[model samples]
Target: MYVSVKGGEAAIDNAHRLLADRRRGDRSVPALTLDQIAEQLVLGVDRVMSEGSLYDRRLAALAIKQARGDLIEAIFLVRAYRTTLPRFGFAEPVDTGAMLVERRISACYKDLPGGQLLGPTFDYTHRLLDEALDGDPEVEPGETREGATEPVSRIADILGGEGLIEEEISGNDEPDDINQTPLEFPLSRAMRLQSLARGDEGFLLALGYSTQRGYARSHPFAGEIRIGEVEVEVFMPELGFAVPVGRVQLTECQMVNQFKGSAKVPPQFTRGYGLVFGQSERKAMAMALCDRALRAGELGEDIVAPAQDQEFVISHCDNVQATGFVEHLKLPHHVDFQAELGLVRTMRTQFEQAESAMENKEAAE
Candidate 1:
């Protein structure tokens, strides 16, 4: 007998309890503190912040712990928390020229006005196991006060020094947030970039790498890759101007691409831009590459490759949405199975009737 598989509600309750126990784990081990997760697993926190679009380190850490160190789950947790937040208003545009840069480098030039600063990066590290960090906990350094750091001028200032690259100019435009509404076509540059920044790290990485591998074949030089904290401001209409709301850690990339001498001008450089939450160089660079690829039609180039497909790039960027829908399949869906059963039964009946007719015809012969 099947036992009729009763008490689904009770079974679900028991499953939830089991999940809670599994998530909490052993009593012998120390409960994972938020600080431990934040300081020790900073990159994980950064990824959660980037994808989740929230900047709270402690909350991100808690999400990581609760998610069992699964980055996607951590991102989902932060995202879930983020939606509950009520916003007062929007911030004003931050000037990159005034950015207090921590790490700034220009691939296009060896020497720039501000000079290169390699603040902190894992690029040089040989990823080997270090038993020392596990043994000795070091004393904390004294906290340096904010704004003690100075602003850096960009490398683009050099090209603009000789009228080479186009200088950015503000126009009448405001972007719609992807989180607020579904992405729509005929999107302005700001909206497109916003989507790409919050998009999947792997998806952007693959799209960026595809260009270097001759898929899109656009020649690109990293005009600049900068990591810094930029001030976000609020335009207080009643107060008549913008005011500093807060500061956010950001990774911004500007790529200069080789443009053919068009009918209007001589051969020169054009730009592709990306800016993302937290310090995410790979995502920023990938966004820049994809940004350039999507500009093919606007820039008078062919739009045949995957990276060049704006619809494709913008459509598949968000990791939170993607991973959730995918992982949700692990939840109960017996209703779908019943539909599949009906389909199979109908097909089986048609096949058996056909087979029986063929067998009877042979017997008569």
Candidate 2:
């Protein structure tokens, strides 16, 4: 066992060196620059930033590079680095309504107030890759319109006004920081949202898919999805005013789900909300679905599905925790194996002795 441990240590060191070499394959080829990754692989960086709970694009890009494009690994790296940073001040809640929208679309309405500005979406693009994009090419800017943008109204709010949707009441309570405190049962909507925001995108995506597949029945329509830049503010107690800290690109998704009238509530459109960092439309939409599913208990709905169970979903959502438990199986378990072996051998010996005594008693008879 001691020899095996020493050999394992040497093997691990060699494996790390080999991995480093493979990560930097082909020395003749130009290495991927951080700027290129930040700009070109923006979506990858966005996922890392969103899941890591850190919004630094540069750091996210670096993590992506170090992890060799493994997004979950990159998220883990970013989170580990984020833990060491000192807390400054918390930013005030962002006003999504006043966002300078880059892309705004709705499946609920045909024509909204601002109209669907399909900005920079790959929805209409062909799936085939263009070989021309393989090499560095100068990007040409497209033509712009001169008309001023109009104020966009939320589809859910419009429905609520007409008594077609559930009333979304704002709460004055401050949200609990899950990072600072351990998660307890009966979590608030704010904590659930925070958990989902930092949750594994793939896990959330699968859970969201399960809801659509009749696991948790929901008639969902994209209420509104907007990708834009919103101002971040911090309240200065001394000045008694909120000051602008900076602007961050965000993707906000609102899923409008059909609800049946229950004993306590009327049949109205209940909405799910998802707000994530950067242009992650799919992740945000999936989060909205999962968020709505998790609200089953609060809404007095049946919790028959895995997605509806807060404890189940929240507990398994963290990739860092999931990965650690799964990967730890590779480590040596000699002590545990020895204990199991002893128990099995003892059971076998007892069975054989009992059989021998029965045979001898039969012979004597």
Q: Which candidate tops TM-score?
A: 2
TM-score of each: 0.88, 0.91
| lDDT of predicted model 2 | 0.89
Task: For model 2, state the Cα shift of residue 360 in Å.
Answer: 11
Q: What is the C-alpha RMSD of each candidate to the true structure, in Å?
A: 3.4, 2.7
Residues 178-242, model 1: lDDT tens digits: 76777678666777888887788889899898988888858999999998888888898999989
lDDT of 1: 0.82
Give the whole-model CA lDDT for all candidates, comma-separated: 0.82, 0.89
Per-residue lDDT, model 2, residue 355, is: 97
